[model samples]
Each structure stands twice: as C-alpha cells, then as structure tokens.
Target: MEPVEINAGAYYLRQLRADRKLDDRPALMEAFADPRHRRYVLNYRLRTPDEATEYVTLRAAQWACDERCSWAVADLATGRLLGEVGLRDLDLDFGTAEASVWTHPAERGKGIAAAGLSAAIQFGFARLGLHEIAYRHDESNTASEVVARRAGFTRVGPEERPSPSGETLIRWVLKPS
Candidate 1:
C-alpha cells in the first residue's frame, strides 16, 4: 500500500520509511533510553542498535501487511524525528483500531503528539473507513491524557489490562467522534 503523508502545520506525519530505518534507529534508541519517555511505554527498555534495527524492521513489516499504521512524526523544516503516532490492532472487519503517540523528550509540550495523532485519526476514519478508533494510556500518564484531549478524543472510562511489570494496568480510552 502507498504510504499516506499529512502536512500538520509545523510538523508532518508519514509512514516510517523502510529505506531509512538505519538512519532512524539512533533517534529511536535515544528516545527509549530517556527515563521520562520510557516510563509510560510498554517494553521500552534501553536498546542496542541491533534491537532497534529489529524493532524498526518489524514496524516496516507491520505497515506493509496493513497490521499497523505507525508513522514517524517529523519537524517540517529540519526533518528531525519528533516522535511517533499510529493505529495498531487494526480490524478492518470491525472498523476499529487502537491509537497511540509518543514524543521525544526534547520535543514534548509542543503539541507534536496532538498534531500527529489527529492526522493519523483522519487517515483511519477517512482512508480506512474506520467506524471507531480508540486510544488508551496508563491512567498515570497525564501527559498522554493531555494529548488525547488535544487530539479531540473523548474519554470512555477505565480498562484493566496486564502490564510488562506483571501488574494490573489501569488505562482509559477515548473514542472517535
């Protein structure tokens, strides 16, 4: 499938380019290594270059297979990788998917996540003919809550799930308008 690109004012949203995975690895690893950025994310440990490469490779495959629609959020002027926003667990039959966003530590509080997430939602609802898109984050992640609100998602209350730590993770979702 052809990758979709969205011009989101100061930032742009585009699929994680398979050809440029090598160049994107270092930034991704750095983002994962930062404590503040890693806390709320699942399976986000400090990664070796090889691990980052493997993860990026899988992301490319997932996108190609239409299992996920992850994109690299980048600054329009410098083309720096700002973060990522995506739809996962995409169920074409049900027209549903889970949305998520993460910003690089240096790029937080700039509305990058909100912009990228909004663009991804637009793609899911319009291009994919999605009936509903859900976004959930750990209840403790106030930052994600802010991004969800800014992206125009409405709260649908809490959900219980298992976390990487083997503890109950209480999360909440915002459904598409």
Candidate 2:
C-alpha cells in the first residue's frame, strides 16, 4: 500500500502527513480530545503536541505497506480534518480486510464516515483487487452500524465474545459488485 488519497464527496481522504507535524497537531488534538472518541476509538485523549505527534507517527507507519491503510477525511475547502477511515488487518492472500471509521465530534451526523468508508471500499475492491471487506464495530456503537449499512455492507451477525470495549461485536461484510 502506497498510501492513496481519495476524493470523497464533501471531503477528501489523505494519509496524515508525517511532515505536516505543525498542521497535524491541533487537528489531531481536536480530533481525539473528545470523550466520545476516546471511548470508542482510542483509550487516550490526545492532549498535547507530543501526543498528537506520536499518533501521526504511528498512522504514518501504517502506510508504505500491504498490511493496512489509514486516511484522514478532510474538508474540501478548508482542508480541516473531518474524521478518519481505514482498512486494517489486510490479507492479500484472502483478499480480505477489516474496515474502521471515526468522525470528528463537530462533524458527526453529516455522513462523514459513510462517505469515507465507501471510497475506501472502492479502493479495496477496485484498486487492490480485494474480494471482500469486513466491517466490525462495537455493538453499542449504533453510528457505526448506520455507516456500514449506508455503505451497503450486509449484516453478518454478532460475535459471541465482546469487543475490547466490553460491548458485543457486531459484524458486517461487503463484497465487490
């Protein structure tokens, strides 16, 4: 994976630039600071530039590989980050990966996750020649379920075990058309 950028309708998906440290600090801090984000996406809230920089470094490393790809969904006009969507646990042999998404607190309810996830699915099936993409999220996260459905993923039932978040894991799958 060479870290592709995508033109989502109201937003674009780009890898969070490792070189854009100054630009990414405030955006990441703002993105991960919310309680909602910490609860569902990550355990720690990005409070300082150093923390945000560390996160950027981690996400940057996820690129330049075949294993995973992550993108920052940004506003078209302002270029502010609206959220993130990614394919993780990629297995080319099986042409499969798990999709994940998170929206900025201020940008919630505007369909950001759905748009970003849809574009990533297209890239997976069309560009990467993947056969299927699996989407799994904490069952308590109704918003993720909505995004999966909106992006045309079929409900594949729930896992018997709970996710790390202590909620049952609901599963969905999207196959290439």
Candidate 3:
C-alpha cells in the first residue's frame, strides 16, 4: 500500500518515510526516561540513543512494506518527531491488528497523540481493509485512556500481561468500527 499523508484538524499524519531520519530519539529518551512515560508505557528505563535508533530503524524496515508494522508520527509544522503510532500482530486473513503509540512529553496535551492515532486507525480500517483494530493500554494510564476515547476507541476488556517492567499489567483494548 502506498503511504499517505493525512490531515487532522491541527496536524498532518504521514508514514515514517525512509528518507526521513528519526529525529525524536533524544527527546524521546529524555521524556521517556521520566516516570510518567515509563509508568504508562510499562517501561523500566529509557534506552540510549543508539538503542532507540536501532529499534526505530528495525520498525521502519518492518512497516515499510509488510502486513504487520507501525509508523512514526511527526509534527508537520516543526518537522519534529512527536510520537509513533503503529499496528502490530496483524492478522491479514482475520483482518485484525493491535495498535500502540507514544508521544514526546513536550508534545503531550496538544492532541498530537490523538490525531496520530486517529490517522493510524483510519489507515488500518480504510487503507488496509482491516475488520478490526485493537488498542491496548496499561490500566493505570488514565492519559492513554483519554487518548483512546478521544480517538473514538472503546474499551473492550482488560488483560493481565508481563511488561518491560517485569510486572503484570491491566490492558485495555479498543476495537473501532
């Protein structure tokens, strides 16, 4: 499928193009290193720049032309990497996929994560012809729940699973119509 640039009310959503280098690693590390991001994301610690780069590079390669992958989100006005929104565990035959996202601390509360997630869900359902898209969040993350609701995702159920922090977490899923 061809990558598209989608326009939200305040931001534009585009694929994480190969030509564009990931520039938000430093900021992401800084923000994610904080407890706020770590707690919600179930992260134990922030990764180094090299680790972040490697991870994103791998994801970029996977999402470039695969059925299961995720995309990066950037600020159209400033060209800054605001966050990432992606689909994982995509079952093409079943027409379902899992979604995830993370936004830089400085970019939060401005609707960036919501806008990016809206674009990603649309891409999954419309562009990819997916029957359902599921978004999961840690139960403690009220902020994530807000984003999910704002993006039109409904809570389906809860799941207990191991996280990077080595703790079982409550998970919520949203299946969009």
| Number of the top-ranking candidate, with lDDT as the measure | 2
Candidate 2 residues lying further than 4 Å off, grouped into runs, are: 18-22, 43-45
- lDDT of every predicted structure (CA atoms): 0.79, 0.85, 0.69
TM-score of each: 0.88, 0.93, 0.80
Worst lDDT run of 10 residues, candidate 2, spans 16-25
Stretches of candidate 1 off by over 4 Å are: 17-22, 162-177
Error of 3 at 71 (Å): 2.6
Candidate closer to the true structure by lDDT (higher is better), 1 or 3: 1
**Residue 27's C-alpha lDDT in candidate 2?**
70
For model 1 the local lDDT of residue 160 reads 59
Model 1: residue 108 alpha-carbon error in angstroms: 0.5
Per-residue lDDT tens digits of candidate 3, residues 41-119? 6533447877666665666666656655565577667666777777777787788888788887777888888888888
Q: How many residue pairs clash in each candidate?
A: 0, 0, 0
Candidate 1 residue-wise lDDT, 1-177, digit = tens: 556778887889876543453266777888998887777776655488787777777777888888998888988876678899989998988998989789988888988999999889888988898888887777667888888888878786666565554544444454546
TM-score of 1: 0.88
- Candidate with better TM-score, 1 vs 3: 1
| lDDT-superior candidate, 2 or 3 | 2
Best by TM-score: 2
Over 71-113, each residue of candidate 2 has an lDDT whose tens digit, in order, gives: 9998888677888899988888999999989988888999999
